[model samples]
Target: MATDLRTSELKEPVDVAEYLFRRLREVGVRSIHGLPGDYNLVALDYISKNGLKWVGNANELNAGYAADGYARVKGISALVTTFGVGELSAVNAIAGAYSEYVPVVHIVGYPSTISQRNGMLLHHTLGNGDFRVFSNISREISCAVAMLNDAHEAATLIDDAIRKCYLLSRPVYISLPTDIVQKKVEGERLKTPIDLNFPPNDAEKEDYVVSVVLKYLQSAKNPVILVDACAIRHRALNEVHKLVEKSGIPTFVAPMGKGAINETLPNYGGVYAGDGSNTGVRERVESADLVLSIGAIKSDFNTAGFTYQVSQLNTIDFHSSYVRVKYSEYPGVRMNGVLRKVTAQMGQLSIQAGPTPNNEIPQEELLSPEPTITQAWFWPRLGQWLQPEDIVITETGTANFGSWETRFPRDVTAISQVLWGSIGYATGSCQGAALAAKDLAAEAGADQVPRRTILFTGDGSFQLTAQEVGTMLRNGLNPIIFVICNEGYTIERYIHGWDADYNDVQPWDYKAVPAALGGRPDQLATYVVKSRQQTEELFMDREFVDPKCKKLRFVEIYMDRDDAPKVLKMTAEAAARTNAKLE
Candidate 1:
């Protein structure tokens, strides 16, 4: 095949694999996560050469989950997998990434163009001649899809796909044919970086929306700010914080928004999940005359099974695409610009000061005088032990619901899959988050302390992706992992099958996993605590949480299988009711 004449004009020509990896490195991806297959093996070699670390995950699904976690922490991530089987294995994770707002570049190594054109049967493909079936499946979940069969078009497609992934904060798919991996493209394109700036909203429409928001705000006697998942995913935390502090209005977060606000603020209320809200948060938010909901995603689980009592008539919702004030919708008006204007223009408000929302854990919720580790006690206690800037990842089960009670310290990031609710997501997410923390720490140099990555997962959920722990050890990442050993899927049991065998999971020796996965004695630490006393002792121990300690610390806490968080019980019952509805 003759090379295109346009390619000969370039001073520097690089392989297609080199261009793809370089683009990923340029877009803040320090590491690439994936499992190597025969098709993708050659492309994997270009990862390290382009200054990006290759994180060989235990499996493709785990790789996808790890990529999701990495993106949550690092703002963008890249995942490489082979054609049919590997890509299909990761579809669930990619779908989760799409449902929630996460930016992950999914790169699939495809069969050669010749094989695809001739309809030659490939080992990983279905017996059918169609090679586009897998890409079609990905199109449903991905924000953009790029097929790199032509060398001339590969650079343009790669750039477009990555930009879409970053700007949309959603997954994008790219199919790289094996024959095209070594094809040369203009290396000069590397000199110019991809355009990442979000297009500016219309000035006239933005002004109108901001004015409408102010009109409501200036008249609101009791206006409260509610933050949710999109606030973090959309990169609006800075604006959200400024609004929270500048306005001094009582503020609260939904379950998915756990770490979006600073808990230490006097006006900062706790999680407000409709019926599952903290002690007084439900009443405080419900009684407000005006509500400023920023980046709100009122999913069933997020809203405590759609139990939110806030009326749309009393709410002003600011979203990435548009602004909704009462029943009026301002299309094309973005929240970031609108918020900046709202905060800058407002001088003062003629609003009555309300009582501060109570964030205190009720005295009755404290650890019982008895020896057991109840859900209520353990969650509240956890808040007291967490440090600033901690990266906390929770599973979709008990840990997700129970964490609502744990108020985060300033700058801490909470990662969970509330909307997607994938079972084994946390373990793989932990590995990626830990790697991101390590990377950030290294970039910050020796003077700064690396933020700790802590994971809270039920034994049942942990069993699904436990192999990622081996990946963590292989990479030498130090993260504190707490496995709640309740013998089965407690969350599932609470939903319907109270004592059914389907909800049961095999009990494994959680502490022995690190050693079995090839951890040296000094490289990691393990503990099993049954009583509240032991847990408290371990938490209070200075040596266990010392910032200087690099050992991977794993703790197994034994709790009764029947016990669950109060919020979980309420939410689960609601879920059960909704699921059984004949309508």
Candidate 2:
């Protein structure tokens, strides 16, 4: 059955670089962070020619942090750099993203096939000679890795790698050989959009686990639910709230899971940690007979370095699909649906609620009678400036303390890569979140309307990815950035105080850096405040919030670096004494 087929003229082949650029565009990635190099020249040229915005960083670590910040706001982030050195420098940030379950796409350019085959001393290559040094580094952290040796596999691999990352909520690496970046391919481009479906539930196992959990809940006089980072990262807040409501059980959130439940809720006890530990909340948790831990990873930082034991209590551990009951059985199931179903069933079994009466600190016991320049002063003032829909990103040191104290509005969102406790993640993440907020506003038909995106970063952290200010100006992102100028790594200084001089950094004119980076003077404003009045006056000013201004604002606060936040200092000192007692 050989019928004569009508032959059509073939179309011109598309440039491989252009094809890659278009694919990234289709995936909604508008910004890329990294330093340019010879190996990535072709892609860089195409990206610039096609009007894509590329953000250059001071170092690869900062680049990855910037991408992480961007992803926190934008839903996904991309980082592009030359192979080996660039990729290696960015590893820490990417690993932080992995630990926090943030989605990021990392692209690295490799040496051409000819260069790799010949034992040439390539730039940035170690003695191993193989240009695939990234594969080894990325194996443990990245959700998946795709190396493009053949031009035919480039498009498919890139698409697949991106899809896998989004699906798994982790970083994915794609290694593009220089030769493949230039080779043209003929085909319809891969256009598969990522699917973000929740992992499937195991009904039978879920039912069995639910029965066991119900028994413990019924038997225990006091039962509390401890929510951690995974709960918020997985967008399981609504489900968790349902579980809490149905069980009529008191709830306490981990520091990383601060805002998972409405802090204003009647059942909300407060945060549970050593120093930041709400005494009333801890009493409830400590007295509990059953503790249902949902999406809680037993990290040293979260569990007070495993100093708090859960072995004695009737605890049910819930992971992605597997669940284990202490002194009982381990069952595996889809947690999302299982949790929902169990909550619904438990709603029928009535349990008395624990005491969550609002507990306020006595004025006499407060840090100081007169408000001084401290995180406590800054937090409440900062809270007053927040509106619904505003996004708050905090760094590890002072920002973490601020996160503990600051209350979020229902419309507001808060984010930080706290699991890894990486210092410089917030500044870069703020840039990305600001960019994402714009897109999100536009998608919701709120484009052209003013939106607020705020970042709280330590002096040490702000320095890591400070160069992103240029990208913010170039993209016209208006975010209020507050550099907590304590003058050093306050968190570390409190913990170790080893070589205090080394911990201290010479203070810079925080306001001047943005101006030097080409930010419009009118749109880009900086302020240094030493008093609460100054902080309030600057933030409450009508001109600063003018919708028409569309400016990027910077505020710096000068405080005593040696005088750590009261609660944090107390905790650190207590921890030191505890360690001493153990020794």
Candidate 3:
């Protein structure tokens, strides 16, 4: 076989692989994160030849997560791997990015067309021969999926996927067949600009919808605006702030949308779930006459399992689809644009009332409770120990409960890979965030200040990625790791309707794991707290505040599986309902 090595110079022909690589680069993808295999050799060659950095990961899940972390810091990230097993491993992380509204481009190489059609059992082939395996897996998780079987169409399809990811701010999958990468096509200058223009709304319908929402806003005595992750993912933070400021409406953020508006704002009611759900915030959300839900997905976790009733007559839900005013609807525009337009039309409304109701219990009342081993009572005292600028990373299982029960000061940062709903994301993410925080503080000349990174992982999740603790120890990064010792996947138990046996996990002495992983016990302290009082005492202990401690610290808090928070109970119920509906 004569190879056309100099085809570009001789015939002005474009190599399909080169075209795909160029498209990725044009979209500002700085690096490709994934594990390479024989199935993706051609694509890997192109990536290497194009001078793009390929970050090899231990597994596809971590690769997807690392890409997600990069996207969180930068704007867009890319990941590439082989078919089937590789793609499946990454599904959790990709799904998480989708839920969180992070833009990521996932490239998966497929078996050649001939092999796919001839029924030749490829190395990674499952029962199915179709190379579109990733397409089905990504259907619900990604904003879009494109498979490039034709070399000629590869440029346009690749570009389209990238553009969609950027515009939708969600993960998109692009599948490349092995043969397509080896083919050649005529080179043409590609037009790669994104069309930012949104489809116009029916003017009359929009005006009517706007009028109805305005009327409800004007009439309600205690209208509250609840912003969620969608709003933040759509970059509507400033617009949401404006809406809250102008309407004089008390504003609350769903757990995922925390930090959208500065918690210090006077109208800021506090976070609705997770560590922000102090008593007053919950009451305000439950009692509001009119609830304006901007970019809120009524997910079970965020809505406390749908236990609280929303006044549909006065509830206006603005989703990615349309402006839903009570019962009437308008064509959906981009989220941030729609919110900005609505707030702009409302003109200048003043802050309607006094500071948002303080819902915190008195210290005396909290202390009066006889100390017991439980998450509910332990969370409140833990909140007092958190300081501003400290970032909290929670694993999916415990995060669902901790986010609802724990209350932190307004300035604290809470982070979780919620959308992907992966169990083991916290440990790796904490390492990434901690590294970033350290760099940020150093650049700002605040290197002397102590930076705290906290991870709240369920026992199940902690076991999967516990190896990262050694990374922290080697790097001399001190992060407080609190393991919720329920002895299994609590979230799964909830999902399975308290089928404890299947949900029950093998218990490990988490505090001992760190010590076994070459972490120093003196600098790396471990404690087991069975009661809220013990938790409080540990947090208030002066030893934790010592600046000299530069080793990983572990804390294990024991709680009965049945004693999970009300929000978790509700979430599990809703999941059951959803499953029942599906069945």
Candidate 4:
């Protein structure tokens, strides 16, 4: 029998929605990202009441993307949507977050339990009235799912979903029924926070793995440390930095791990993406006798279309769940503990002089007389202008591939969906990243400069999520956005259709978009650059770079339709071959 709130007087009973929002606040979710739907409208009221900001996104998909970005910066985030239509619309974004190991709690609003019990057809549901179908679909991508049909179990389920999302570092799904939104649950549960601590590895197993890693470290003549996206996802970057600084081995990052290491370090080699790597990086990484690979995810894009040449016999792989030393496998042992122990116990080995990463633009491109903004000239040139601790976001286009050449300053966070390859993700992601940066800056007080969220996206991709700019403006966020106006999907063109009509996109006055999106003229700045000199002038502008200027800086950069970054060209050619007929 259910505990009737009207009949029985329970002490300190809390609404289900209030409990959920409070839990989100406890987990560092300062803002709730989603659009209000009819089913979820009442629940939205609890967001601000629980000390959380409600980010009303233009659409559900963009909301999901924004939540993903927030999670990448703030550790965890929440998204709310209506049951079927809204939740289905955000599926692609949720899938992308799952693919990239981002923790976003996707809370969906469903019809009342009474409606479902009577099999009544609902607006957001299928005609068959099966309420579980949507959640069934979500289980494919989500690490955990909580169906809140019963008020008794609602609080427990919500806690479980959120904990799994953080521990597993992936998306989770929660279904909140309309009638259940205000259902009374035990308020005392909120007093005890969810356990977010990772379970420690078995002491004996960890010791053995650490010793095995140490043995290989001492004997190798040439050893290198390769960091990847998982190092950031699994929160092992601190351990990675300690090992890199203490060991002084040649350190390199995969394409997806661009910002994991400090580029100023003496042992920091540039990105090592097989054929796409700078010649120095490829040769050094491939020739090494020993490689300490931390949290590596060698996807096609990450490895430059499956071109990584590192041998497994020479590599020691460290992962969140386990560590592999050469051919030996150590299961149930986590990387954080193993890496910490390995760094502490390891002795000195042969430390060779490694390549130093730099941001110097190529001499030929700098001296070129061409007026058009070429990829080769723009990427390295932009590197010179980037500041410390900047949050740089790149779309899955030329911007993503081109940015591999740019060496980042200390503490800069690079956000991109490289493995998922989701187009237009950067714009929406930029909104959440800017908000997170704003929150962080406030916490740091007036002494520290606020981190700028900069976005580099192609015109075609920008058109997909342009409405997100309006949301950013409404929130008073300051982000520097660059739209590469090449007139089409340059990446797809390079892959299959060079001159096909399918790849072409209609041109728009991108500079006029913010104003049309309701930005005040005084608060917004727009620019158009077609030449290298103009680009340089904009980069050096004092007002543009000033943190005090609280304006959205939007720039439209024009380049030839056929021009693409060198790395993009190589990777595109490889992708084409992979899609070609077998011999």
Candidate 5:
């Protein structure tokens, strides 16, 4: 029996900050990321009081990225910042969250209602005393926007904004006035908690879409399953896995959906990166008569510059909002529910018997540990060495493209900003991902093996948000940070200037970053690997891979300044041609 969350007999009075924090806590936000500001200081005080720790980031932008990472694992996360300057600083990360469908509640602290009404000049204001400008800017990126100026109706607005954040799986904005932080409000609404139950499906639309999908699926001689980024966003991975297992169809994941499915499955093919796909991935997907595409996000990076060859006549696109079978589309039919039904009814429906998916990745020669580590040798070794449930965070430049060919384990989770394609996002997000992994481990019980967080980033990207390494140390996180030191923005160099000074970056003592970033030298190990011999030794070391190590490790792997992954090289040439032609 379900516990009735609503209670009409009792009501308590609580401050606005208490209500907000309590509500966030109820929804599984253990740590709130933010930068301290006078406007939001009072609210920050309530965080610890409510059993939540404040994850003080080095900057607001980092806080935003960290919040996004946490939300990706915990389902929802919160980030607090000052009204104007602080909020604007985080807008880029918030926009990325909106694009990627991560639920993050951006709480901003604003001046009091009196100051706004009187047009008083404030430090964070635009000098004209207009408080509405920043909120207007937020409206464009957030799914819902709310200003908590009226204490009487503040609860409703807060609940509504948070609901939109979770339901849409995107960012939402909440502006809390300084004076409203401690304002007394009735807490009767808190008894019910935030309503997280998704809306019921329209039976007719669901049935119609399912039937159409079955029709196409049954008739096809060769059918395939393509999972995309939205599968993880919409929480449809389990259902998708079931559908693939039951249907016994060949499955291939898009670039952004690298870890959305178990790559170890015999029917699981490699990533689909348009023309850049591995030897057989693109051909197998395009040649299929019927394609089941779940939660697809067709960004340029994921689709190899919009070069997908699949046609509408052979595609069944299952999206979060609707489902499409060839020429016909059913509105308001979510795949989350429909997939479970489809999986249960798989035997009753028709399906094609096809060849098992080829799970072969390009094999590398058994090189004797060479003096230098090349792209050819590094990525394949990393893929083969990865353990189950090790979360990998790749930066936008070489790391992202280099990770494309890496096969993940059964429950591995991969994180990247493919759609937003933001540089300097991985380091900050790595902090949150590690913390979330810790929380997840605790929840899984002592018997469960602890999950490790591994981050692969380039030199240029790391320079932008390098301060988060200190935050990680302060929080006692033990992530393996691999800095690919190629001496510059190699990704950019591949696009325009092969040897342009503008693309050059100053060399850093990457191995010293851990100790320099407040990590105790003894508690951390730093190593520089200029050869395959060193990399293999470090990767195979028990201290680096085991949970009992109890220390973070930073490894700097050196490569040629002009070297880059083949996929990135190909994409760069294509991008350059398009740019030269003004396409």
Candidate 6:
């Protein structure tokens, strides 16, 4: 009994619970995030024993959101739930993870296999005794799904689920029966790391595709590089940077790709979204003889509702698994390798895009500004105050659309669920992102510059998951939260109702939210800014975002209820037209 459990020499068979948790630790899980249920109580007993802290969230949906946020920063994250109800409550968050390519392992503890087979009704089930329903639903959203009924195969199942979560950078599902929680399983698989075999490209095909892309690059009179969200998801930011630098091609970022490439780069063009693009960006890209697009996701919000003018014939795409050059296609040609090859040979190519089209980044005009903050005045100023190494999470509201225009500082990782379009995401995601940043900062030693985890959310979105603020407080995480006080669903208003009562939300005292959410007064700082003068005083103050501050800060900024970013307004019009009947 006294033998050290941590020692690898012990080679003893361990319970399935120990096996599962230890495997997660080996793959870089520092903590587990979820709500506790009766089905998982026994499994929870082994959490602290394995040296992992349980991040008890206020609800399953928020737990899923937090876990997704954590996974985006930490490389992979796991969430534990119980049976059908708890797991189903997190489905929306899981879907968001899938759309955005965040690797999250969602584990569900269910009734024993004996009960399921005997048709015993379970509390969380629909009373139909059909245990396969939830798993079937999960299969649609997850890259991999495994339900473990046999102890002998549990190790391999768990390993497969974890590997899928990483390889695809998406959510994976695992079902664990209650009776199997303590079953004995082999521990030998723990010695070797998870075998994540990503196959290499075919030699001849790889060379052919690379040559085709390079030939276009050298011959084009105006070649443009377009970077999008996939560049961040596939871990190709470094390669994209090298390609842009070496080719000397003018680069533009899609809305989903706001923070992937540093905006300060000399050849950096402004944001491009068809009709919503910055001045001169759309014209330059559409006029190009060839466009080198990397990880481009053409979501509605990302492309201004598919208003793009660039043709497929002039576009050469570098995707995660394949390459598309004009009309020809090359499957199994990995982009990671292709990008490296293209970047290395850039020195031999001739430059084409002339004079490097430029536009002056917008600056806030303070003269005769509104008494209350307006969307136009605020976003630009917010960008001016951003610092290096800041982690930003924006919700799917005015914050999401407005933030696309802001130029981020160097190393600032901005996260927005534009493709998923989930409201209330930033509240829970900021909690997870902050914890990840804090954990990474601690690992970097005592002298590392502190990284800020900041959240920009609308009032309606905040109400959906404000309880997560308590989770942040409990963990002693310091994140700056800016709640946009626009009265209701402004984004929804833009799309459908201009003055509908359904779009209105109950107003609450925003400053008292922290205390109502169980945050101690001394542990938090609150601010309510109603005027342009006040907004400037707070964000511009160097002491407000000071790295030395140890308390979480919350700020509520008031703006017009109908106000929205110009790009979002345009997209909303397009969305309305799409929803309308034949004219």
In order, the Cα lDDT scores of the candidates are: 0.90, 0.72, 0.70, 0.91, 0.85, 0.85
| lDDT for each residue of candidate 3 in 465-576, tens digit (9 for 90 to 100) | 7776765665566888888887788777777846657677787877798778787765588889887667767777776755445666788888876666656665676777
Evaluation by TM-score, superior candidate among 1 and 2: 1
- Give the per-residue lDDT of model 2 (tens digit) for 18-64: 77667666667777778787888777877866656777676788788
What global local distance difference test value does model 1 have?
0.90
If scored against the real structure, what TM-score would every candidate get?
0.98, 0.87, 0.78, 0.98, 0.95, 0.95
lDDT of 4 by residue, 357-380 (tens): 687878888788888899988888
lDDT of candidate 1 over 281-366, digit per residue (tens)? 88889999999999999998999888899999999998888889999998887799999999998779754444443335457655
Tens digit of per-residue lDDT, candidate 5, span 377-409: 677778878888888999987888888877777
Query: How accurate locally is residue 501 in candidate 6, as Cα lDDT from 0 to 100?
Result: 92
The better-scoring model by lDDT among 2 and 3 is 2
CA lDDT, candidate 3, residue 492:
75
Q: What is the lDDT of residue 99 in candidate 4?
A: 96
Off by over 4 Å in 1: 1-3, 351-362, 365-367
lDDT of 6 at 255: 87
Tell me the TM-score of model 2. Answer: 0.87
Give me the displacement of residue 134 in model 6, in angstroms. Answer: 0.9
TM-score of 6: 0.95
Worst 10 residues of 4 by lDDT: 3-12
Residue 342 alpha-carbon offset, candidate 4, angstroms: 0.8
